[model samples]
Target: DERLGLVQMAIDEHTWLASEAREGETVELLVKSHPHLSIVHFTLNGADDVLRYRKWCWSGPMFRMITMGRCGDTEAVVARACRDGADLDAGHFIMGPQMPDISSSAARSALAREDIAAAALLLHPEVLLWCREHKVWQASTEPLRRDERLKHTNRPSGTPQQPC
Candidate 1:
């Protein structure tokens, strides 16, 4: 029944659209708590709003989707970590609650991974409060947006994430 319950929760979570105020509040919380990372609640609706100062949060620079309720399992938990700032290449380092890589060689590998992630999540409760990000982006014909932040980063400096 636990798995079924999780499925239902995920369904419910995805059904709700995050509102502008809710998204701003989530960004504010993340910025206040995590100075090392950046936060952006990018969405189609806010595209015309100039990414108002409070609407975006970043300490120096860094940045997320998926709601907290859907984070019932480890993969989602780890995805949160990856979205927050924990690099997937960083290895088994704890991101919060812990667990899985299904393609692993052993049968129990997935379970073992899950337990680790779940434990990490429990260890750091704040991660649960971290904003759920729709990490994936949707593209449009809008002129390429520019940001000075990416000068040193791999992504093209002039184009933030839109079509040129």
Candidate 2:
């Protein structure tokens, strides 16, 4: 919970920086603050306009963020990608079967990793479809949905807002 709070603060700081400056320093600060989060690296360098940003996200660590289920960050990236008219299906394909050097089993394992349940909530339709086709969807995501619901209902009203 503390880590999530720190991440929310970083997201807030990132938002402020994006409005105040155009340099990479904001992203750098985020990375320095939350180096363990793949989302931080993706957010820093993937702030360009939609097409360029999507291209960068696909090419850089942002793709991992997507798979890792950093929901707020992934949502922001996806929103930008959609705005730029980038095809979500292509991105899904790349992150799924087309990812370099990983076998299907490995990719499936990656998808079913600890954070994957959250990842499923934000995944593109194509990726979700792929998971369903591969029989990995319901088993992995259902329990997470239940847990998320409980967490949401139990959280206090004063909790800091995430940057989704």
**Model 2 quality (TM-score):** 0.20
Q: Report the Cα lDDT for candidate 2.
A: 0.39
Question: Worst lDDT window (10 residues) for model 2?
Answer: 93-102
Which RMSD values do the candidates have, in order? Answer: 18.8, 14.7
Candidates in order have lDDT scores of 0.31, 0.39
Cα TM-score per model: 0.19, 0.20
Q: Tens digits of per-residue lDDT for model 1 on 70-107? A: 12344544454456664434322322322222221221
Give candidate 1's error at residue 113 in angstroms. Answer: 51
* lDDT per residue as tens, model 2, 1-164: 32232233335535553221332346677777988985333322222222333453344324322332232344555566567565556543122121223233443454556445544554444454444444442344232343443343322223332222
Worst lDDT run of 10 residues, candidate 1, spans 129-138
